[model samples]
Target: MTWQSHLIVMPIVLPLVTAAVLLLFDERNRRLKMAINVISVVLQIAIAIELMIMAIEKAPEPMVYLIGDWPAPFGIVLVLDRLAALMLVLTSVLGLASLSFALANWYKASPNFHTIFQLLLMGLNGAFLTGDLFNLFVFFEVMLAASYGLALHGSGVARVKAGMHYIVINLVASSLFLIGVSLIYGVTGTLNMADLAQRIPDVAAQDRMLLETGAAILGIAFLIKAGMWPLNFWLTPTYSAAAAPVAAIFAVMTKVGIYVLLRLSPLMFGISSGASYGFGNHWLYFGGMVTLTFGLIGVVASQAMGRLASYSILVSSGTLLAAIGSGNTAMTAAALFYMVSSTLTIAAFFLLIELVERGQDAAANVLAVTMEAYGDEEDEEEEEEVGTLLPATLAVLGLCFAICAILLIGLPPFSGFIAKFVILSAILNGNHIAPNTAAGIDPSSWVLVGLILLSGLSALIAMTRTGIRTFWASLEGNVPRVLVREIVPVGALLLVCLSLTFAAGPVMRYMEATAHYLHTPEQYIQSVINTPRVGGKTENGK
Candidate 1:
């Protein structure tokens, strides 16, 4: 195998090794550990970028790396394609930003914070790259295990309470994952995704119902993780309660579920899969619409910025789910673009929330709400109006908050607007709905478009309300003592969102290609199953 081939596995191995090395150090040696953690993440980002370039330039087919030189359907494999590479780069970037923010002080919340963080990255990268369902379960557990620690890292009442819920919900999801995998294996006699895709079309009539039943159970498990409505009651509380940096990294964690759904739906249940074509799509579409509506309600109702940010995540997930369920190539591409834009925006917002709230009291939100709802009757003493210069730190925070609001609201001049525009356009122009035609747009498509627009407006209202309370209403409030480290990560994340705006053309092209590739899974299947083992020898010495 070439060196580029070897890079496919480095994302997983690098973090695994770094976490092990971190265990050797004493908790007192925090600076060293932090340095090591940052360096490792930087390397991960570099490697991920290189792999992305390789995926785009050198690889027209999915790059497969066999573990122990074992061939497909028999041994573990990592498959790197345009989509997987994009996810790797996204994970690494979020990791670096979150870790940088944590180093400022959050890392001190737990001695093993850095260690657990690396494991989380390893798990995320593995989940994206793995080519088998069983290993996907294994990686899901690893990611969730690390998240449990991160969620409860600071050991606060709220954090612990929410952490326990998070743990329980994920544990149940994991159980369903295993059960589904076992059913699939029993019916198909294969756990490898590529093999399963190849066999799904021919699944015997006797077992077709069983296969789909297992698939439905598996979809439920992923939907819970994706924070789909009804299944997502735990998401808001858990995410809102997590530490700022931890929550920031977690902005991408939910996407893992979305990614798997996107990967499997087309590969295993596309038009080629006789009886199973487009299975569960209606659920995804309608369920996503409900999730989006629920999230919009939460966004408007949220009293805390943390909860608002968490709800925004649901909004992003719901949009992606709906887009994927539509099964339109254009919509999927647009969704991918929105996914990247929204994740970065939300991550920055999560990190920014901590910084913004640093100077405010615990009851500040409640006080603001109470004052707004009722009347703050006080002695009427009119004082001469005086203009005070905004402190530099507060100014930066306010500006960052405004940018986040704009992005979240899908306002103009950012990638968020571009993403939403494309998505709306795609929905209007979808196969079922022809633009400027006698049929007009379908009712479902119209509902989706309206919901998306309403969600954006709702986000604007929520963010504007929160911003006024936090920054404008509290003019006399103490300026938050923001560190360069914390602020820099938030800035970096927003800067990335801006970069996406400037590079939207190229980025959209890549996403379109990825969506096309996903829609056509035959290439992926053949590549994974037909790739020769090392030394050009199979287990049977063929």
Candidate 2:
């Protein structure tokens, strides 16, 4: 009931209101719409940061806001914990960067671009904050609907083709989401997440299998969104085909699935859930390893930068899923750090691809691949000028490209390297195993470690090859006419990654606390169920 509790809802409401206001303006008033959109997103970032600080200070206990002044297990609620707050801030930052980039040119692609963009943010913030299973489904649909428009924003042959596939795949996922929700609701008689967590352990034996069946179906739906191996065939092409800014924001869409898994898996199926303990974990583990391996292959085989960036997203997702499946507190914390670092890097890479590809012929990639496959056959008369100075714009692009490569490859002196190192150390040290046990580390742990290292090496090769073709091989290529507006967003994203590198200690501490909190489901369930409604009335009216 405090004033600060009200801030939890603004992230969702502000964008919803802004999108409605945007609809009132004529398409010709693009500058006005863009200005409004930018201001709204900036306010969201401010609000998200404030919420994050509050969540940190509050630690362990979540801030719950009840809708309609109704108590838990009966009414809608928004829960803001350390993890949810972190996601809110991440989503807001990515939104601002992507929107800024779009304003430069891509916004002109459609009259409703700004409108759809705000809706997407609304859906993302809602999904992150909602405490009810049904509301989560609602938000998922909203996010997917908005993404459909954004994917086809430019409406080229490739974009449309990929957009259709994206639409179809998500539609199927949404259907599965609904069916799973219905099954769980029927078995448990509750749709509120906290309520379900409290009720899960008490479900009758006859209904245990049914409950898990529903949960498994639900997991499959989320895995599809997370771009897990076989379910992810549609991902690379669809992401590669999206408009630059749209694709940049879509980077976080996959994480939405990961976030839900991080929240629900522990809360509903942890050690406390008698027969259901550790359900679906092995699937996540093996699936993640395969996804990582497939992504590494894609990264090395990709001929286009867009596809390469898309594959890198799969790599990030696979790593997170595997770490989560391990169920190690230290590994989960490290994965959270890696999640933030990789998301920002991939988003920046998507935006940067637009700038780097500008003024280049479409056949350039093909030609570069061909030369590598066969020969360039350059004439001796066409002597290369080895000492020529690079243009300032090209130099800047090259530098940004190199930084992205380092981040993606998990090389030293960056957050990516720190995250990977923490994960590897956590696994190798057997932190998850009991101190008194004689058993060694799990073999699956070794497989995960190998996959992570090999993925990094593959990424290094792919990025280096792409960079040489983009910056060095095409010496005569025209320097792109980059705009300050466009370049600034990319710079801002990379700067945040660099900030993460320098501030790894504090960030890792926060993530560790979050992971610990997640492992303790009792605290979360108590906080949610015990939160009193307005006027100091309990759900039981005591």
Candidate 3:
């Protein structure tokens, strides 16, 4: 009833309402639609920031909103904890940036761009806020439905082909999602995440295998969404073919899978799940390693900046998966930090890629020919001040590109480096392991270390090569004609990542507190299940 109670649902409702209003207008009203879309997104960002502040100030008690004043387990509830609030903030900011980039002209590419865009945000926010498994599935479908439209927006052959693949794969994933939830509900008699957490330990011995089986199948669906290893082949192509703004917003899509795993893994299968404690940890660890390795290979082999950015998403996903699977509270906390940094950095890169590549191919070809013809004499050309102050347009693109490279490669004086350092330090210092568990660093942790370093190195090589070809080697090209709208979004995204570097202390503190709550889910479970019916009248009283 109070305004504060409404905060939990505003993120989902605002977008949904705005979207409905926009759909009333015809394609001829593009300006009106965009104006509405931009204002809605800006407001959502403000709301998300306030909710995050509330979550932090309130600590472990999540803000829960019951729809229609219904009781928990009987009606839908939206919960906003530290984790959910953090995700909401990320989603809102990404939506704002992507929409701004689209305003430069991508919105006109499709009649339904604004509609689908708002629906996508609604789904994303809903997925983060929902407190039950069934609603999670509903939100997944909503998000995927919008994504199908966005992926196919431009109507190019490549876009259509890639979108088709994306659709088919996700359709199958959705089916598995439903089947898995059905199995879990069939045995547990509950779909509420908190209720499931409470009941998992009490599952009959005969049904334990069935429960694990269902969870495994469910995880497969999540992993596919997260773009994990062998299942992720569709991601790079799809992302590479999408419109720039679509690709940019999609940087958070894979993170949705990571979010579910982080949320449910701890709440349902944490230290409380009896023999099922830490279930699927090994799968996550090994799968993440393979995914990270595959992503690094893809990055190195990618000739196009779009494909490289796509692979970077995979690397980001794998890093988080591995961190979560590590079962180390500190490591998970650091991964949370890294997730925000990587997602924002990659989103900026996606938008920048299109701008940087504009009118560049001709110059690249000419430079290549010049190099081949000059052969040994090319050293003289290379020695010329490659860093000579660039033109304004090129200068902005080059600076953004350089920052992306630094972030992706986990280089110094940036949030990316700080994040990676936190993870490595947690591992080396044995923050999560007992002395008896390992003499020094566990071999698994060592493998993680090697993978982290090697992947960063590979990413550095790939991004550096692309940057030189696109910016440095393309010096002969005309200055890219980037609009202020496009530049502002990309710059804002990069600045957010930069700000993370300065705010690392407070951010890490928040992450540590979040990780603490995750590993100890008693409060979360109790708070949700013990919640009274919203109205004074219970079913009997009514």
Candidate 4:
């Protein structure tokens, strides 16, 4: 295959390779690791951009590579479809921004930080790109294992306990994932998703229900990973405890699980034969709805700034999955759009939080310095300092209030608005499912959609209330010095949100087409099975 024939491999390969090289070096070499980190991140971003361009130009043909040159249905395949490509792009953007922020605020001397970070990226990239189910599990493990370290990056009692729970719960979920895979292999005789896509329908009807049960179990595993519902008890505390940069990157982890669900749900469940999801899509639709509502409620009630923001992100995931489980192209596309928008918004928010927290620290230090110099401030001087300090930070908090409001409420001129527009249109009009859903009583998919609208409004109100209290109501202190490192990350997020207003057409189109591919696994199977090459080179030939 020509080099361009497999551009998708670069994102995964570069990070893993860099991690390997970094692992061999001493932890004290901060300068070298930082250089490698910057370089690898830059490359990942470049490759992602290239793949997106290729996807747009090539249309429906995705870039897939068979490891060791084995053909599809037998060998492990790495696919770079629109969804996969989008993930690669989003992952790197988050990674880059977080890395810069960490540089500004974290202890640069920590030996393990660079190695673990690279591995985390490796897991994320692999999880997004892998086509084999077992491989997906493998990548998930790889990522979460690395995540355990990052979660406790700056060791403390709170972080340790939170990370332990986070680790233990995920391990249980991973075990369940393995169980699901075992049951699937036992029933279908294949772990290759494309092959299983064809074989599951042909299984004996006696075992048909069992196959779906396994699929549902598998869906539960991914949902658990996605931080949906009761199984997600570990999310808020874990996210809140991690370092700012780690939290920023961790925001996208749930999305990877959703990406897997979006890829597999249509094949596993639905109206088609051989589907694995049992009791129909209603299970997912309703389950996702509950989680969305619960998550948003939690977001509103929570106060520690990081935890509140993290819960809001979780709520976004639930809403997105609910849209997909509605089982329609329009709905799925809307979900993907929201996925992209939410990722950007959350990353931006967390980075700003770091800046806010840092500024607070700086202001505290400055106050100490002033007090030392003044030999204790007189009441009038204290009053004057209080007045000045409060206004400046209030302005920064005002910025946070505006951005989080846009994300939490799905407000417009932002990307969230674009996503909401598409979803509401799909929900209100009903999708292809409505004509078929009426077979059962009360099959309105729109009922599930209410989960999104109401939660979104609640998140808005809640975030707005917090903003009013923190920024508009009264200020306890002054705004601190902004982190030079984070300014760019925050700037990038707001700018992208602004730009998304204009890029809505193209973004929505890509998402729609991606949803089209996911809804019809036939294209995925055929694309892999029939792809040809010169001298067994494995060219796309799509």
> How well does each candidate superpose onto the true structure, as a TM-score?
0.97, 0.97, 0.95, 0.89
Clashing pairs in 4: 201-274, 268-276, 268-277, 389-478, 393-479
Q: Candidate 3 lDDT, tens digit per residue, 403-522?
A: 999999999899999999998887776444222154566677788889999989999899877777677666556787889988999999999999999999999999999999888988
The digit string of per-residue lDDT tens for model 2 on 1-542 reads 57988999999999999999999999889899999999999999999999999999888898889888788989899999999999999999999999999988999987799999999999999999999999999899999999999999986899999999999999999988988998999999999999999899999999999999999989989999999989998999999999999999999999999999999999998889888887888788788899999999999999899999999999999999888887778878999999999999999999999999996887766777898999868756766677978899999889899999999999989888998999898888745422213576677777888999999999999999999888988834789999998899999999999999899989999999999999887888988898887876547977
Location of the lowest summed lDDT over 10 successive residues in candidate 1: 430-439
Reference-based lDDT, each prediction:
0.92, 0.91, 0.89, 0.76
In model 3, where is the ten-residue run with the lowest total lDDT? 430-439
Model 1 residue runs over 4 Å out of place are 379-381, 432-438, 538-542
lDDT-superior candidate, 2 or 3? 2
Ten-residue region with minimum lDDT total, candidate 2: 429-438
* 135-193 per-residue lDDT for model 1 (tens digits): 99989999999999999989789999999999999999998998899899999999999
Candidate 4: count of backbone clashes, pairs at least 3 residues apart or interchain: 5
Q: Which stretches of candidate 4 lie over 4 Å from their true place?
A: 107-109, 274-280, 359-397, 432-446, 473-475, 537-542
User: Would you give me the overall lDDT of model 4?
Assistant: 0.76
lDDT of 4 at 486: 61
Provide the global lDDT of candidate 1 against the true structure.
0.92
Q: State in Å the error of residue 25, model 2.
A: 0.3
Candidate with top lDDT is 1
Ranking by lDDT: 1, 2, 3, 4
